[model samples]
Target: MSATTDGSRVRNLWDEAKAATLDEPGKLLYRSNLLGSDKRITNYGGGNTSAKVTHRDPLTGEDVTVLWVKGSGGDVGTIKLDGFATLYMDKLNRLRDIYRGPAHEDEMVGYLPHCTFNLNPRAASIDTPLHAYLPYPHVDHMHPDAVIAIAATRNGREITRRVYGEEIGWLEWRRPGFELGLELARFAAENPEAKGVVLGSHGLFTWGRTAEECYATTLAIINRAIEWFEGELKDKPAFGGEVVAALPRERRREIAARLMPEIRARIGRDEAKIGHFDDSDAVLQFVGSAALRPLAALGTSCPDHFLRTKIRPLVLDFDPANGDVEALVAGLDGAVEAYRQDYAAYYQRSKHPDSPAMRDPNAVIYLVPGVGMISFAKDKGTARVSAEFYVNAINVMRGASGVDDYLGLPEQEAFDIEYWLLEEAKLQRLPKPKPLAGRVALVTGGAGGIGQAIAARLMAEGACVVLADIDANALDATKADFAKGFGADQVRGTRMNVTSEAEVAASFAEAVVEYGGLDILVSNAGIASAAPVEDTTLEVWDRNISILATGYFLVSREAFRLFRRQKLGGSMIFISSKNGLAASAGASAYCTAKAAEIHLARCLALEGAEAGIRVNTVNPDAVLRGSKIWSGEWREQRAASSKIGTEELEAHYRNRSLLKRSVFPEDIAEAVYFFASDLSAKSTGNIVNVDAGNAISFTR
Candidate 1:
C-alpha cells in the first residue's frame, strides 16, 4: 500500500474496538476512519463506507439485515457510529426495481429517508443504494488519487483491465443514483469473482465479508493502480525545470499577493472572498508542466471534485517570474470573464428547468505557472479544501498523462452532480454565516490575551486571521490553538515587532503575498507603562512611546499603503486604553502614549476616508486578566497605589464603573470587531470605550 495507508494503525483501531465489544456499526466506523484519514484515498467528506449487519426489527421482533453506511455531512475520518445512517438492505435494494429507466434522482433521494431503519434522524449518503446492491457484507467506496489517475483517462477501462484483470470490474460514467446502483448490481452478478469495481470518471468501490477485508482490498487495489501509474511515468521530466526555476519563492508570493485581490474583485464585489496560494512543490511542479494548459482545461479528475473545484480551473497567462501588476490583472480579468461566460453557456445548455440556478461562475482553482495554484472561496476552510482537491487532481492527471490522456466526466454529467438536490441540501443546511466570511484580518500582538481573544473572535466570524506577534512562542501557540479550533490553514502566524519599520513593512508585504490582501488591520501592539511625570525617565518615556505610540503608527501606515494599492476599503483598529482619555496618578508615560495612539488613529481616519479606509480606537480599562503588563511588580505597585490586593483590582475597577462590571479582553475585542466589520461603515475617527460605563473614560 502507499505510505498514505497505515495498515497497522487500522488493525490497531479495529482491534481496540473489538476489545471493547464493539458492534458491526462500530467496526464500520473504524474502517471509515482509516480510509478517510488518507487524503490520497479521499478528501474531507468525500467518501462513503458501509457494513451489513443484523439487527432486530423494531416492530417485528425478528432479526433483519441492514446497512450501516456513512451519513451525509459527516467526514468519515472523524465520524462516530451515530454518523452512520441505518437502512434495511431489502428496502434499499428494492429501489433498484422501482426505478428502472431514467435516473429519478429526486424520487430515489426522497425514498431513502422513508427506507431508513435506524432511529438516527440523519440522512444517509446518496450512495446508500450502491452499498445495498453489493453482495458483500462490507463495502468501501473512495475516490483514491491513483485509481482516479487511471479511471479518469481516455483508456481508463482498458487500463483497469490491464492492471486488475478480472479481479476488478469497470463501469462507465454514470451519475450515482438508482440507475447506477442497478448497473452495479448487474455488473456484480456478471463478475462475482471480482473483488472491486471502478467507475469511470468517478471513483472505486470495494467489498468484502468483513471490515478488515474490505479495507485491505481497497488499499491493495489502490496500490496496484498507483504502482502502474508510477511505472508509466518512469523517466518523465515530472515538471519542466526551467519553469519552476524562473520564479523564486519571494517573487511568486509578491505576484500572488497583488493578483489575488484583482481576482476577487473580478469574481464578486459584494462580499469579501479569501484566496489561498498553494506553492508546494507538488502543486508548482504540476502547474509548471508542459501538459498543464491542454490537460488541465479538460476538467477535474472525478465528478465529485466538480462541486468544490469547477469542471475546469481558470488558467492565467501571466508569468510569476516576470509580470507587472496591471498586465496580470488585465489577463485575469479577461480569463475570469471568459470562464464565467463559458459556464453560463454550459448551464443554459445542460441544466434542467427545475434545477438550481448556477452558483457563482467564479473559478474555484486558479492555475498559475511558476506561481503554483490558488483556490478561492467564501471562507478559509473551503478554499483549503478546494486547493487540496486540485493538488490531488493535478497529480492524478500527471500520472494519467503517462498511461493515456486525462479525461473527466462529460460536461452534462458534471452538471448533474454539480446541481444535484443532494449536494444543494448540504449547502442549505449550513446556518447563515457571519458577515466576515472570506474576509482577511491581521491582528498585531495577536498572541497576547486580548490579541488572541480578538483573533479568535474574528476567525469565529469566518475571517481568515494572520497572528502577528513579537513573541515567537506565543505566536506559535496561538496559531496552533486556532488551527485546531478552525483549521490548520485558516490562521497563520508572523513574528513581527511593530515598532521596527522594516519588520512592519515586510510583514504587510508578506501578508499581501501570502493571503492576497488584508481586509482588517488591528493595530493593537502596545506595552503598558506607569510613572508620575516627575518620576518618569527618558528610558521609560521612550519605551512607552516606541511601542504604544510609534508602533501603532508604523503598522497602520503599512496597512494604509496596502489598502490604497488594492483599492479596497479597509478598517484599522487601535487598542488604546481608558487612561488615554482620563489620567490616573503614577501613569504619566502610559497615559500620554495611549493618548498619542488615539490621536494618530484620528489622523489616519481623516487621510484614509478618501481611500475607503476606516480608522477607529477601542479604549479598554482594567482588562488585567491577560495583560502581561499587569504581572509581577507593576501589577503589585498599581494595586498598591489603589491600596488594594492585586487580585482585587479587577473588582475595584468594576465597582468604579456605573455598570459595575469588570472589563474583559473580549469586551475590547467586541469593540474592535465593530470597527472592523461593516457595522461602522458610516462611522470613523471614533473611540469606543469598553470600560464598563466609566464616566471619566467615556468617549467625548
Candidate 2:
C-alpha cells in the first residue's frame, strides 16, 4: 500500500471487513499477503507463512489439525489459495521420531509427502517443519532488512536482548530443516513470554494465537527494529562514509549502457543472460562508499541474499575522478576470469562427497564505483529481483556496520546451502527454456497489427521486447496488452519517428539501457503511396522514401553498431513487401522504396557475415486485416487500380494467390520468427514470401 516503510513505521493493511468474510485458511492467505506486500518486510519468495487450522478429514470423517504452509517456489504477495501446501500436523510431529540428527536432516525433506492432507499436490518447503513445531495457531517467517540487520551483527544475540528485551529471543544460525525445527520448539518451550525469535544471520519468526494477531505482531516487531535503527544510527555515517561522490545521473546511465553489453558478452557464453541496472540512491551510496570493496568481498550474510546475488560480487576497478572507461573495459576480461577462479575454489573448498556439481562460476551481481549495480540472469525478472536482493543486503550492512561489526555467513555453510542435493532436485524439476529465452528484440511500428503479432510471437518463445512506434496512444495500448499476456518485465515501449537519425539512435540507446543490449531488430515501420510516375509530385516521392527507405537504413545502421559492441552476433529482420521484387502499375514511389529496403539488407548481410549478424527479409502482400497502412487512402487507391471495390480486396487477393488463402498478420509473424531465431542460424541475406504462394514474387 505504501512504500515498504518510511523509516519508522510499517503500514498495517489488514481490514476488519475483509478478514470477517474469510474462513481460517483464507485468513492465513490474507495475513501472508499483507506481510509480503512490502519489500522492506521480506524479499520476493524469501519467507513462508502458516496456520494450524481444523479441517474435516475426508478419509477419517473427523476434524484434524492441518499445517497449511506456503508451498515451495511460491511468493506470498501474489500467492493464491492453491499455493499453500496442506499437511497433517500430527504426521509432521511424527517426523521428529525418525529425524536422527543434523547429519540426517536433509533426508527429512523426502518424507514430507507422506504427511500430505487432502492430497494437496503443492510440495512443502523446508520451512514447513519450523511452523509445524511452533506452539501457535498462526506463524510467520520473514527476512525484513531492519530485523536482519540486528541479526547479522557480530553480537546479534546481545543486540536482540537490548531491542526487544524479554519480548523476543535469539537462536544461532542453523540451516532450515528438521534439526532447526527442534531447536525452535525447544526455544519456544523455554521462553513462554517471547513473541518471536531472530534466527542468527537469517530472519525473524513470530507467532500468535490467531492469524490477525500473528500478522500484527510481525509488523510490530519489524517496525520496532526500524524505529530503533533510525534512532541509533541517526548520526552515523553510512557504509563508513562515502569515498567517491556519485556521478551525474546521465553519466551513470551512459557508463552502465557502455559496460552492460561488454559484461553480457563475456558471462553469457554458457547460457545467455538478461541484465538489469540500478542507480538508486541506496545502491549508489553503498557502491561509492569507503567500505564497498571490503563489504562486497565479505558477501551477503543472509542465505536468501547470497542465493540470488551469489557468494560475492565482482567489483569493477573504476575511478570516477579519472573517468577512464576505456581502461576499465580493457581490464574486464581479467577481472571476470579472476572472479570465476575464486568461485570455483570456494566450491572446491567446501563441497561434500554428495554435493551437486558446481554451477556457472560467474558473479550474478556487479559493483561499479560511482556508477551503480548491475545484475544478469536467465530472464529480466530474475535479474531485477537479484538486484533488489542485493539492495536489501546493503540496507542490512548500513544498519549493522554503523552500530556493530557486520558479519557474513560462514563460507562452508553458504556453500552447503547453495549446493544442497535438494536444491539441485528443485532446479532439475524446472521447465526447459524456450527457444528465444534471454534474448532482447526491438520492433519498429510495434503498435500496428503485424508488429504486435511479431512481438507476441517472439515473446511466446521468451524474448524481451522493446516496442517503438510513432503513435504514442497506440503504442501504450499495445504495450499494455502485450504486458498482460506476457509480463511487465518482458515488454517496454518508446515513441520514435524512425526516419529521424537522432531519434533512431536514442531509441537504440534506450533499448540498451532497458535490456542490457539488443539481439534482434525488426525494421517494420512503413508507409504506402500510389500514383503514376508522370503525375507523382516531388512531395509524394520524398515522403515515401523518407520513411520507407532512409528509415530502414538509420535503424539498420544503429543495430549493426550495437551488435558489434555486444560481439554476441545478432539477427535483423527487414519487413519489406512483395512489391520489392515485383513491379506494380502506378505505384512507382512505393515500389522503389520497398526495393531499396531489400538491397540494404543484402549490403548489411555481406558486411555482417564474419561477425555472425544474420540479415533477412519477410515480404507480404494484401495483408489488409488490422494493418495501419491499409486503414488509409492506400487501400482505396490499390482497390481502384485493381478495378475492384475496397471491400472485395481480401477476396480478390485470396483468389489470385496460388494457394487461394488470405494472408494475415500472423502469417507474416511466423516468417519473421524464423529469421529471429536460431532455426535460421546458418542462413543470411535471404527473403521469404508470406503471400500465400505469390508466383511473381518468388525469390528464385
**CA-lDDT, candidates in order:** 0.82, 0.93
Ten contiguous residues with the weakest lDDT in model 1: 1-10
TM-score of 2: 0.99
Error of 2 at 98 (Å): 1.3
Q: Candidate 2: lDDT of 533? A: 98
Clash count of each predicted structure: 0, 0
- Model 1: clashing residue pairs? none
Note the residue pairs that clash in candidate 2. none
lDDT of 2: 0.93
Model 1 TM-score is 0.93
Top of the candidates by TM-score? 2
Once superposed on the true structure, which residue ranges of model 2 sit more than 4 Å away at CA? 1-7
| Residue 448 C-alpha lDDT in model 1 | 89
Tell me how many residue pairs clash in candidate 1.
0
Candidate 2 per-residue lDDT, tens place, 1-700, comes to: 4345454589788899999999999999988888888888999989999999999999979999999999999988888999999999999989888888888888899999999999999999998989999999999999999999999999999999999999999999999988888899999999999999999999999999998899999999999999899999987889989899999998988888889988988898689899999999999999989999998888899899989999999999999999999998988999999999999999999999988888999989999999999999999999999999999999999999988999998999899889988889999999999999999999999999899999999999999999999999999999999989999999999998998999998888788878898899999999899988999999999988999999999999999998998889999999999999999999999999999999999999999999999999999999999999999999999999999999999999999999999999999999999999999999999999999988889998
